[model samples]
Structures are given as structure tokens and as C-alpha cells.
Target: MITGKNYIGSQLKAAGTKIYKTINPQLNIENPWSFIEATPEEINEAVALANDAFKIYKNYPAQKKADFLNAIAEEILALGDELLEVYCSESGYPKGRAEGERGRTIFQLRTFANMLTEGSWLEATIDTSIPDRLPLPKDDLRKMLVPLGPVVVFGSSNFPFAFSTAGGDTASALAAGCPVIVKSHSMHIGTGEMVASAVIKAAKKNNIPEGVFSNLIGSGVTLGTSLVKHPLVKAVGFTGSINGGRALFDLASQRPEPIPVFAEMGSINPVVILPDALEKNSKKWAAAYAGSITLGTGQFCTNPGLLLGIKGEKLNQFIDQLAEEIEKIAPSCMLHPSIKADFNNGKEKIQSQNGVSTVAEYKGEIAPNYAPQTILTVDGKTFLENPALSHEVFGPFSIIVQCKNNEELLTIINKLDGQLTGTIIAEPMELSNYNAVVDALQNRVGRLIFNGVPTGVEVCASMIHGGPYPASSDSRFTAVGIHAVKRWVRPFSYQNWPDELLPSALQNKNPLNITRTVNDIITNKPI
Candidate 1:
């Protein structure tokens, strides 16, 4: 059970509220957890502390900030069994998922730490003064990335560890030298508290300010709204449903100061199966897709909710095989009871839509809170006509769309909303004729997968985990990989300042000895 002792940095205070622990619906057991709702006063205090921390935190040396991030990762690892247990109890996710997400969280923190020590990510540039130009000599200009102020991060329920407190948003913000306040997901408050403790420990070890990172627990939207609308909050990061993310974006934009909100909303993550490819590997592809759709009970945002294909005998064969394979898989519990309820509702709604047919559903009774893996299909014309088919169901369910022709396939892809990923399953020769379809997919999604499942996200430097509106608040930026830090930073230019007065990344000598672009060439030596 969490006690007052667990509230790191800040003393536990009474805010005139009753507390309740979240129950595990699958196990029929009460988890040892309760969260203190942050009053309006507490919210202001947290944000104020973060704002103050930003003053020094934003200007702190990159190496020092790196140390803090690395320490947090280490402390989280040190939590070991305790962290994973809390994750599973609160989220109802299995042990493997809890551990995997914990690892991803740690990897994210350490990756940013590496970025800090290695330097050179700042994208420095030096334009030597045009001393002999026909026009008046221009001042020598230098540019590099600089930290924004305090940031507010809203964690997603699906990934409480990797996208919650001390997750990608907080890690990247800290890496960029910005203070962070995480609006902890109510679904996994225990996980959030454990991670918050890790951050506090790291802050102490690194001698960073106490308020550099704060975690606020709340079940409703009020706390999140206050944080994003708060004047001191300079930026926001979020991952959740389209409705929730859009509301936050609108709130931020409506603010008097109008801060940037990088919200990774919902995605159907469409997968296009070409006729030839289906014909070539119908059984194998069907099996692989069954695994992907059922993996993690389809909790992943990249779950291929929409499958598109040109209508033919091959397509029919593939759908039948897929239905058979999907039925063979067992139903699993969703992350939370609320999620399961919503999943069932969404599936029913989709099934009720005109021209929709249920291909597969759990025949046996599912235990409480379990999600029955379901497969539904609709024609290309009906899918295109009904916008409801395009929405995300957020569970282990998939809708197969049979397009009448290549043109219909193209039209469906074009008409679809933005997505985190768009996949193309094609035979080698068939791909040569589908350049337009591929190009259209690329334009609509942040990442394009070729003949591969989109469920597994590779944590690497080049990965882009964000996409166009509804998929994410900003298509220009990414939510994962080394580039996630870009969300917490903005470009700042200095014009001919004295070498000693400039930031280290922009100084004349570049004492950090990082590479800079000069005369269209990357060089460590400054011009």
C-alpha cells in the first residue's frame, strides 16, 4: 500500500477529498492504491514550481541535464518488481506488457541522456559575415535549438508506463532542459506515483530543483484543462482519443498566450492488402495478422483496425482465412473495465451500421472485463459512404474493407483520415503498379510499413511515431525516437554576440566541439 511516505519532495496535505483504490476486475481483488486529487491551489503551486525550475533548468548545461535523465532511468530500473506489480495491478495488463513497457520507458530516458552527452543534436549553423558583399556587410549569424519553458504532459491510458509519468514526454522535455508537470493518467495512478518517485530521486542525486518535475493525479478533465490553459505552461504532449486530444489542442490555442500542443490522438492504422499479395500468401499473411491484431489484446495505437483490399476471389479467400485464424485466438481482458465497456459499445455500434456483417466474435462467454476478439467486414462502397467505419474501436477488433477495384482502393486510402501508420501488403511485382497507392499512404501517415505488421514499434533514431491531424496534433514533429526532444525545444538565433555571451552550442569556438553546418558542410571547426 502507498503511504504518505511515498509522496516524494512534497508533504502530503489534506485537500478535503475522499480517496478510493482502483479494483482489478479480472481478479476480483482490490489493488492497494489511492490518489490524492490536486486542488486548484495545488495545481497552481505545482505549475509555479515548474515555472521557477525552468529559469535555471532551461539554462543548465546539457551534460548535467543528461545525468538527471540517466539517473531517473536507473532509479526506475531499481524499482524492479515493485514497479511492474503496480503497473499490472492498476492497468490489468499482463506481466510481459508491464515489463516491456517499463523497458521502453527506461530506453527512452537513457536514449535522451546519450543525446545530451554526445551533443551535436542542436543543429548548429554558422554563417560567416559577408564582409565584402555588394550590399552592406551582414552580421555573423549563429543558430541552435533552445529549451522552451515549463511543459504539461498528459499520459495515455493504453501505455501508462511509456506514455505516462516519466514517459516519453517528460523524458524528452527534461532532455531539452525544460521542467515538466505530468498530468498522471487516473487509470494507472500507482504506476505514475512510482515513476514520480524515480524522478524525484534522480533530481536529488543530480542536485536539480525539487519542482523540476511534478506529478498531479486526477480522474477528470479539469486538472488537465487547467494545466494546458495555464499561462506558465509553454507546451503540452498527449496521447489518447481524438475527442480528448482535440479538446486539449483547442484549449491551448484558445489560451491568451497560445502554446504548442503535441497531442498524438487516435489512429485506425489502415492496412492495404493487394489482391496479388493476398493470392500469393493468404494463409501465412492471415496467420501473421491474427497475431498482430490479438497481440496485447489490440491495445496498441498501431493496431490495424482497418484492412483494405481490392475485391476478388483472392480477397474473399484471405478474409475467410483471417476470420478462421482470429477465431482460434482466445479473448483477453482489456486494460481497464472502462476500456472493455467502451470496446464492446464501439463494436456493437460498428456492427449496427448499414451493410456491416460480423465475421467472427467470441462464441463462449468471456470472463468479467475480458475483450472478445472480433472481426467485421464491410464493402468498399459502404465503408467510404459511412465515416463511422473509419473511427478507431480501441480493442482487439478489425474491420476488413473489400474495395471493388484499384481505383476504389486508392479512393479509400485518399479519403481516410491521418494515421500513425499505413501498411501495404504487396507482392514484389504487384508493388511496381501501385506507386500511387503507396505515395498516397505515405502522405497520410507518419510511418509507412511495407508488407509488415505495424504493431511492433522499433525504438530507433529514425522512427517517427506521430502523424497528421487526428493521428497527432502536429505532423511536422515526432512523439518517439531521438527527435521527440524537438517538441520541448525551439530554434533560437543569435546575431554576432560576443563569444563569451553566447550559449555554448552557438559560441564561436563551439567548446563542446560539436559539428556545425558551415558553407553546406558539416564540420567541428567553426569558420
Candidate 2:
């Protein structure tokens, strides 16, 4: 029932010499379906179609856009169990995870739908003319956020639903009135196409333009590179490894007209454990972290890969109990064989480094692509002296750093690279005394968690999923939440223009009934 063809708008095309098949990671076998990679010509055509669609989609009424978004969610939900089956078969994830992610995806789509319906995302502003001023008269100026043309979204390998084709990037781009061209993740192209079909069906149901969405199938760099360097792609959204994201970032920057690439890359997500917390509730925190470190096979970007604490008898006991807790849990199959191999290689390299001590490693392996849980520890001096020791291993793996004292711990925390999230475990009011440590962690991470593991990210209005460089290409934008739409938009001003000729949101009539800053005051009043 799956068609291994590219969704170039509403059209399905299978014209390309390059072909690949999805692998059943648990069985280490190939799936029956074969996918045709998108050729350069097909890529060009998709971008051209998207650019054309953007011209009209950008000016659509907020209600119309909301309708399209709601339609997408409905169609996806219609897929139901079939979608979950294919997702589980291709990605080796359980039905529960697939269903949960599908629900999250649907929730995200509906959230954007509601946001657009409310008609307040534009951030409209106005300053009326002062023609009778004593000095030079001020000209009327109005400004609001507008779509930034076509966007290219690269689907994530690990997250087939929430961050793949028709995922956050696609949802936010479409919500901002920009046509989206998604480079489907090779690991789950079938799953990608399944979701892409729902999107195309929704587009038609809602009477949206033909090129409002496109999903391209590929397993190589050629497809992604061509799209990123294309002149029509005004912005890009990517979620992947550091090297992969940086490659697209560099390619986009070197284009004839440089475009923005909002890439969510690597993060260690360091967790600092203060002394009092260990003395009071060491066992509780230990049990919690054991589950968090190995959650979802440690595939989460916000997974607490690094744990910091001052050296003491209590810390040693906590470490031992935590390691034992991780080993007790069963291992799960990773998304692909390559991911398993990478985990093995990266973990081995980190373990081989000097002064590293093994805590607990899962000795019972189950399947072809199952990742074994690992917990390693090293002294603070060794970690600080060796910068290579701080890199992420990217699986159900964690490294605990034992510091001589709080000073060394803060120094180690201060020296870390940019991260998606950071955590501090301490007794009540203990964090207040370590203001400098808190500030240092705050500077290094985009989100700060107090006495909590950084495993689950809540999708909402106030969440900051992006952080300083290496965590993401830019810290000012988020790849989650409703605000994610801002990445695909830019501010535009209309100066001294007639109300009839201006955008509906900026017109003096206040047709949208959305809040606007008029003469430095926020109001929804009509002139």
C-alpha cells in the first residue's frame, strides 16, 4: 500500500536512477518497499512550484490558513493504526511511542490552527502621521511579520513524526504562509510519505494551492544540498547531528544570496547535582536519573548525557545505585543499524579516554540494532583538561563527572559548550547560594531546569527549544511551540500607505480585531 515516490506537491513522481529501501532495524533486514531518490530536476521543480505557491499563500486570510492546518490534522488522524504500523516497522519503535508521537504531531497542528484562527501572530504595529507638528511632520508607518518565501525542511532521523515530514518545520512554515519542501529522512521515508500523503490530501480538501507542500525521498547528501543552495529557498529548518546541521548551515551561508538555516544540532545537556540534594534525597534523584538517562534509548537531544557532582562518599553511593538502576532496565532497538554502529563507536572512543571508569553496562543484548545502556565516570580534572572528553555519545549513554569541590564543579560547568538544556539538583534554597554557578549554566544553555531531569520537553508558547550555536544555528528562534512560526517570517513595514491599500491587519479599520501597538500604546480600537 506504500508508494515509494516523491510527493512533488499533489503529484507523485518516481523518476530517478538512485533507489534505496528502508531497513527493519530489529531484524536487520530490508523492507519490501523501494524508494526512488529525487533527482536534481525534481528538486528544482518542487522549489519552483513552492515559490509560485508562496506568492498566493502568503496573502491568505488567517482563517483560511487555519482551515488548511486543521484539515492536515484531521487527515493525519484518519490514517490511524496504519500509520502506527508503518512507523513501528520502519523505525523499530513500539506502538505506544508511535501513537504518542502521532498525538503530539496532531496536537501541534491543531495548536497552530488555533493560533492562526485567533489572528494575533502578526504582531502588527502602527504610528499615525503628525501632519500638524511644529517641526517636520511624521509619516504614518505600519509594520507586521510576513512570510519569508519558500522554506526547506530536513526531516529528523530519530523523530519520524514530531520532527519529520509534515512535522514542526513543515507545520510552522505552512502556518506562517510559506510553502514547504521537505527532504525526507532516509531512515523513515515510508513513514514520511505516509504523512506527506495526508498533507497533500488535506491541501486539496481545504482548496490550498498545489505547491503549498512537497516531500522528497532521498538517502544521500545530494538531495539536501541542492535544496539548501537553491535560490528560491529563503530559509531552512533542520534537526540532526552537529556535522550534518553545520554542513547545511555552511552551504546556505555560502549561497549567492545567503539564507537563514535554523538547525537544532548536538547537545550534552549537562546536569549539575549539588551536595545537599545528594545528602537528603540521593536515592530518589538517582532512581529518577537512571530512567531519564536511558529514556527512549537516550535518543532525546535533551537527554542528560553528562552529570556533575562534588566528590564525596554520598556521591559515590549515588553513582553506584544509579548505575545499577540503569543496568536493570531492558535495552531497546535503535532506529537503524547505522545509529547502533555510531553508538558503539562513539561510546568506545569516550571510554578509551584516560581516567574514565566504567560503572554499569548492559551485558545482555537482544536484537541486531539494540543499543546497550552504559554509564561511565571520570574525575573533574581529567574532564576539564581533556576537551574531547566533553563531546556527546548520542545514545543510552551517560558520563558522571566527580569534582574535588564546588569551585571545580562550577569551572567545569562554565567551560561547557552550548546546550539545549541544563539542570541543577539541589535541596531547597541551596541553589540561591550558588548564584555564579546558576548564571554560568544559564549562559551555556537555552533552557534551565531546577531539580528535574531534562528528558521530556513540553511543547507550548513559552518553551525555548533552541539555544546558542552548536545547540542550534541561532539562539533567537525556537523549533518547537507556536513561536516557531516566526523563523519562517520577517517584519515588513508599510509607510504612508492608504488604509484601503494596506494589509488587513495594518488597516485603520482593525478588521482582524487583533492587538496592535498604535502610537506606542497596545490597543484593538478602530480609527
Per-candidate Cα lDDT values, in order, are 0.86, 0.92
Candidate closest to the true structure, highest lDDT: 2
TM per prediction = 0.97, 0.99
- Highest TM-score, which number? 2
**Alpha-carbon lDDT of model 1:** 0.86
Worst 10 residues of 2 by lDDT: 217-226
Model 1 residue pairs with clashes: none
| Candidate 2: tens digits of C-alpha lDDT, residues 1-527 | 58899999999998897888999887789988899999888999999999999999999999999889888989898998998988998998999999999989999998998898777788998999999887788899999999999999999988999999888889999999999999999999989999999999999998899898999987548888899999999999999999999999999999999999999999999999988999899989989999998888889999899999989998998998898788889999898999999999999999999999999899984787998899999999999999888988888999999999989998998889999999999987898888898999999999999989998878899999989889999999999999999999999999999899999999998988888889999898986
Off by over 4 Å in 1: 4-20
348-421 per-residue lDDT for model 1 (tens digits): 99999999999888788888888889999999999989999888999999999989998989999999899999
Name the 10 consecutive residues with the lowest summed lDDT in model 1: 4-13
**lDDT of prediction 2:** 0.92
